[model samples]
Target: MAEPTAPPAAPSLQELQHWTGVLGRAQQMMMEAGIDMMAQLPAAKAAPAFPAMFDPAQAMRAGAAFWTDTLELWQRFLDPAHAVRAEESPEHARDRRFRAPQWREDPVFDFLRQSYFLIADHMVKGVDSLEGVEPRQKEQIRFATQGFIDAMSPTNFPATNPEVIEKIVETRGENLLKGLQNMLADIAKGQMTQSDTSAFELGRNLAMTPGKVVRRTPLYELIHYAPATKQVFETPLVIFPPWINRFYILDLTAEKSFIRWAVEQGLSVFVVSWRSADASMKDVVWDDYVERGQIDAIDTVRELLGVEGVHAIGYCVAGTTLAATLALLTARGEADKLKTATFFTTQVDFAEAGELSLFVGDEQLKMIDSLSSDGYLDGRYMATTFNLLRGRDLIWNYVTNNYLLGADYAPFDLLHWNADVTNLPAKWHQSYLTDLYRDNKLVMPGAMQIAGTPIDLSTVKTPSYIQAGREDHIAPAHSVWKITDHFTGPLRFVLAGSGHIAGVVNPPSANKYQYWTNEAKVSSLAEFVAGATETKGSWWPDWLQWIEAADATRVAARGARIPGKGKLQALADAPGEYVKTR
Candidate 1:
């Protein structure tokens, strides 16, 4: 012992007794949050699966592995020479809550973030690894577990989040008071605010493209967008947007407006403005929308243009109805009336429908029916269902911004439209859920009926252009691909770069996300993707080209400025009375 042994080195700050204790407390809070959310999973669906949901032996093994991993991490963490760092990979770095400088630069927070992920990631893998559970039921469990984990992120809690702590310190606890007030305001609004709601109006900064409402119906109003070119395609184009949402989404602003861009392309463009559902619409059925709301709009466009054939485009749910209408028309031997059909992020087959399917089972449908006080689902209910699909971006992110950080939402036109939810008529919704979602009837020959006409998708042979968003969750690209199977005619499938709205509403001026195409003969979406070529601009031009090819005859462009040409008359300005109401 000639050289006195140096005193044992003290633990690194990351592994100090006090820091470990702090982490233990933080872990407790996260676990409590997870427990609270787990308690909310629907008992009706989950109770049956509970026995098969998790193997207790496997779960214990997972728990033990998690602890083992944690111990190993602590060993590396305690080494004085080793520094803790958050994963730098794109996938791991996406948790925006940890983007703050301190989260990575400070070892304490770095350890906390890593620890939470270690636990949550194990839980996710464990749920995924569970065997013997029915495939569909297994999917529900996985989804619920992920949502619960996301809700319990360390960034969501005030004390666990250093950014929020700094805000409190900077504002001398006034941030808490402001946050409380903000929470109260959000509660009053009945939904979280994702944009500056007061910053945009229906016709001013948003949905500002010039147009006029023509031929109003009880269910919808047809709009003739003011013409942008002198000569236009002879075939008029009518857009049947999803009635579950307002029509202005396609008409938002001059730049992002798909409606405006179509007019500018020297095409006769008309849109259907659907009336928001009320108690009066309780008895409205699927056939009513197909007839009065969609088919009627198509008839109005043809009549106004004095054309035997019209081009029709449908978005989301409207596209499903369009498909049924195509079949119904075919049953009546009037299939040629619609010369061309275009579908935007629409699904006819529910076999591979995304997270929305979780809400379509009998128990949930019963709940929805019960909530329909006078026979209509509230707008907020649908909004909440969609919001839950992307809880991190849609729910907790806003929670941190509006509640913890006390910040006002940035003004965004798209989000403003998103906040404007649409109510759904009960009968229309019921038939939709039962026929399409529950029974998968639309694609089956003679299985679906619209009005008195039996619908058979294969009987409809109109040329079709199907555009599906690569990132769409509601209508997954795969689910949308099923349309190609049933169209039974010349069909072009295009995959765009972004999610549903961004992918569809994309304009070339912005020069943003890319689209994919495949000219090679391919039966399945997988083959299409394998042979697909990438294009670095909006799909709008691609669609215009398809429209031109579908019908090349040119006619004088007609706009709302003209009083009436055939059987249509201008009723009011665009972004009409229906859209302005809730």
Candidate 2:
């Protein structure tokens, strides 16, 4: 027996160039027809800020530094000793992009990886080193620069990426052919595939919690999950997931479903499945969401069960509005309408709103208005904007896996939910940014109004629980903690580990991630951290304990709201009509 001959040498640079061009054409098809991804980023449409970011004086010094690094890198590349050795710094070791053994063992690839980082570092610091530029403009430039660098990673390209090159060689160019096919399939689907969507469905595998849609309106479907326990708490619990995505994220799977867990633990759960916005909802505004969407749900639920107040949980943008709804109820002398409020990774004080704020200025707003049709912001456009938030993980990772390596996406419940994007009323979306994100007015007393009532977050007396993700980019934990400044109610703030989705969707059964807790009121986030105690595992159990302790009264299973002829009419099954709109 003899070993198989070694595969042919990696594809030539010229051949790689052809594949790169094919990739460009492939991406053109992935975006939804008649939608422009660039319209969301007005800054990107303007001329390059070579002069502003790197004025002539600064450019010269940066150029000299770059050339010096390039010469040193070239010299090392020519020498077998340094070229053959991997860049073994702790920083490089942590980069997932350079984790492949070929990046270290192969000389040519190692040089490319090191050179790319060298250039990326210089580019980032060039803007940081600028003296006279406005802080906002400088920040925008820095974000754009980093996005460009992430896009041009050696691993994203064919010729430079050792793993991609090897895959191409091993497959005898079949990978490239299959990659094009994947691109075409994604194009037909109208967005990039983040997971094996075919493997999951709402009623069968995902959002399978036993429940029924008790109420339906033009804007939302109110779902009342059947009592898993024999008895339920007196105070009914309602959840308002962010309208930007589907509602079923909270009820992904039986084991992972937060809704199911809450119900099984003896709490009655009701969730608002917001209607996917269309041109007919063009007239909808911020107050409409507060009045018709959230407040209405609360009103109906209370009226049905003859309950005085409803316990509320809001996640992301929904949490942002739920805070305002509390204030609105207060202004109307109906503060008691809501018994308690729980916010998950929500931002009321946008002072530290993070990267999402980068696209909330005048130019971006006006461009969105113009791009909208019948006063509706297309879901596809919004999806692209969000995916760019962590372009490397959300966008480029799939680019390399599905296209470069010709691999299929794994079946991930969360990613499947992510790809099922929802549209928003243009008027409402613009006002959300202008009021909360851009102006930072939700915290200010009487700064904004909902349904003619002033929003004074300080007057919100409802006992509150706020949970923020420590590693969350969308809503930074520090910003979430700012809720403490205004709310006079007894509040418990817990900082959970991981990013936005992972942090919030965590279940006790998974035993994944950790959370921090502090009892004393602190002036700054730093102080809160200093006085806090760290506990390992999911924060869900902690939240359950906090909410459960407040409402201990129990009712028989028959007393729980069951959809039927006597009670509210069953609109449809759980993961109802509105959730399946798209």
Candidate 3:
């Protein structure tokens, strides 16, 4: 069978135009150099058309060496005594392409695997050594090259992959028919593959935490989780989860739940479950997210808990909104509404926003706005965009399993939560892309406004705790650290182990990841990392302790507080209507 071809990644028209101009100039420079070279060497037959960085002679020599290596590889394979051993590399850690016992003994498969890695390394090095290319162009070339490399991975093709071959033999070709059926089903659904949809149920298996929706608005639902402890903190804890996915990420399972954990710690836990957007919410803007989303949720929580101030925690996009809201409230001299603020992998400064930044800029932003002008931005588009960033895991892995190997996707809570995407309001998403990613207005004092008040981050002096994942590509740790400079009050920064979501979802029981915390404020991120202390396990307990210490003065044990007792009554059961909209 033919190997699966890599998804095309042709350069955009803009990139092509820019590079065409560069190449035209380069050709002009080469022609000029050729004339000069011919003038210097009267006896020469022809002039060279090469740039200073690229020497034809050197390229020829490199090509000769590559073939020499290829010849030696073949020679070793033909030798009777030749045997191959498993080679491990950081890039190919989880790759099980050539792991079968036969690969070690089979000369053909061994040589192919070896040659593949060698060629990939050479290509990467050549790209890295291109001195004359623009930084952005270099990044694009590398990204495209990496995609090709992933596509060429032996496991992606059933014939070359030993595991798939073994499976075919064991099942007597039954797996191929099953794989075909899976591919057909995926095509029918307009999905790349089956994402193991049966793995999770919204209210039954997942998002099962006991809670009641005390307040509901067009924008979001405020969920007050039933407390596990008798006495709760006088200061209520309201969590604002990212609207891109469901709020259940915070309450995924009983063991991994940060929400349930807080409840057990004697804190009145209130979570904001954002409504999945549709055509009706096409007019919802960033202002609506601020007023009707965060502010409304906060007000409802305060009213129910009867607290003057609430401890607020925001994750990802929600964190960005919360920070902006706090800035707006501060401008209006109402900063005292929040007791302590915690931000999880939130990027206020978009300067170093990582790979996602590639999809921004004027042209892309205009395209996005134009496409979603009439209605909400489809969740599938956003999901595909995110998946493209980590295609090896999110895209091609499923292609290999569901299409090539005929394997059922494993049940994973994280994957299920990730697949449950939420739509973005047209105006809201456009404003976000324009103000935050495009213009980077959040870091600029008085640059953003909400509710007729200019948002100045410097005026927001609420005590803060910021946590960022070291490997978080979406919101890089460096970008999160920049928030410290904009904040007027004391700030603590923690660098957690793992990627964007896993780092935040880490529970103490997992005991898998480690975190770094620096007590002393540092001028630069490097300085902070240098002085940071590494602690094994989740950063949740440390954050909880920080909030508890800040809110030391507590009231008598009040037992589990009932939702809607104070003001807004319970509208429905926990995980509310908005969460189950999809």
Candidate 4:
């Protein structure tokens, strides 16, 4: 008790001053760190003049209007009784964020919230006004700026976020703890583990369609889905999905499976299940994908079906590969192997290949080559690039749910499929990036080569049905339309009303999206889109109709179409070992 009465006096003035100086130094260090982070943002060469956006007066007018609205919002927030209704912008909505009663009714947060939007809007304007920069550089700048803005979002921090605060209080900080654990777990994996692996077992719940692996090569396995109809079409349908992902995207679930729907429609459906490339397959080049991947699948399908003609489908990069294969086959006078061809979200002309083209510059290509010293493009690298293309949905969305809210995202089949990625062979990926993406070579007649054959897409005379996604960033609709310019055959082009995956995976039953069709082939994409009429429901039925018209003879579908019949032996069950590897 006596010692407590003589409690230690306050620290000496010198000690207090020293502690103050230490705190000041710590703040200076933090500020320096922040400046370093900003300095590390991607750099770009100046772009050409921004159109009308370069006028200073116009910018000032916009700034004045923004400030006026901000002042009004502030005035309303200052009022005691009047509840200020937060303005909702399309890209960055704030009112919808702080929905909890405590936040919605509070004036203090209202001011903080609107101020963020105003500042973000200013930042975007500044980025948009950037002139004399290359398109890739511009994209990098916009992307970096967006990352910064998203990081600064109040909703990401519990102290500034009312919703997170309420969640913390209600859950007694369990949410924060779970979020930290989730973050640490992802950091340990060196990648964002987007889906709950415990929630899905590949062969059982995901790629459960019943079929047989009719043939296998060093590169892929060909799976023939069991026919769900009593009679099947005479011309067998072979699909060449992009090697960047597993073929099961077309067979993700029974109800939504494009293969199942085609099989049900009485078409003998065969999918190319591309093997996830490893260091062992590093020598595999684009020719291998063409010859061994698509060409081999076609040959096996012909042997199994005993039909000289087969209908072929290619999606995204596979569309490019399939087109190349068909061209090579046509050059070799073996074009009769495929009766008809359908391209989904494919880009033969890379002139307008959308945002993904930004990653194919000289520096990026060198980096990729260095990475491929092991002989394959890492699947995680490919996945990360694709995620950045749609950062808001694929990156930030998962980040918020998994790291901020400490919650598991609702189990989504598409999200699961997206998370599942495949590697590209080093030689193959290098050729693809250089020839297709960088040089825009495939569109040029005889500019590319495969299996010692000079490839020219114009020689690919297979009757084609080209389907594009309206919002596809990987393969823009404009780029897909350019394929029509290269093809000499009858081309039926349609635009589905969704992005890359959604546009193709759209099943008729969902009735969730629409499509656009124009029978007349126009010279420009604008004309095509203008003349096209929007049709409700999925484009699958229309595509089926097109393929069906190519070969109308229907035979009795008594048994499931297996792969190994005459020469090729049955390798394994459907969704073979290749798809389950990674």
Give the alpha-carbon lDDT of every model: 0.83, 0.82, 0.77, 0.76
lDDT of candidate 1 over 1-582, digit per residue (tens)? 498755444556555878878776766676556545544566424665554544678767866887777776666556636745334557668867788977765656767788888768776786677666677776777788888888878889998799999999999988888888988998998988899888998788888877788788788877787778888888888899998888988988788998888888888788888999999999999999888877788777776667898999989999988988888888888887899999999999988888988888878889888988787888998999899999999999988988999887799989888889989998888778887888888888878677766788887789999999999988999999999887788998999999989999999999999999999888899999998999998988999999998889886654433434445666788877888877
Worst 10 residues of 3 by lDDT: 41-50
Each candidate's root-mean-square deviation in Å? 4.9, 5.5, 10.3, 8.2
Predict model 4's lDDT versus the native. Answer: 0.76
Residues 396-438, model 3: lDDT tens digits: 7887787777888788888888878888988888888878987
Query: For model 4, which pairs clash?
Result: 46-132, 46-133, 47-132, 47-133, 48-132, 214-563, 231-557
Q: What is the clash tally of candidate 1?
A: 0
Q: Which residue runs of candidate 2 sit more than 4 Å off their true CA positions?
A: 1-57, 82-89
Residue 302 lDDT, candidate 2, scale 0-100: 91
Per-residue CA lDDT of model 4 for 1-582, tens digit only, reads 355444233446575456445433533343344334434544532333443334578667766765676556555544434755665776554344545554444444545566566666766676666656556666666766766666666666777677777778998988888988988987887678777767766677778888878777778877877777777898898888888987778877777888878887888888888889888997888888887678778887787667898999988888888888888998999999989989989888888778787788777889988888888888989999988876766776666677777897577777788778788888878888888888988878778777678888887778999998998888888888898899898889999998898898989999988999987858888998889899999999998888777888988764335445445567788778888886
Task: Supply every candidate's count of residue pairs whose N, Cα or C atoms clash at under 3 angstroms.
Answer: 0, 0, 1, 7
CA shift of 285, model 4, Å = 0.9
Which candidate gets the maximum lDDT versus the true structure? 1
TM-scores for the candidates: 0.94, 0.90, 0.86, 0.86
| Candidate 2 per-residue C-alpha lDDT over 198-272 given as tens digits, one digit per residue, 9 for 90 to 100 | 899889998998888888889999998888778888899999999999998899978899998998888888999
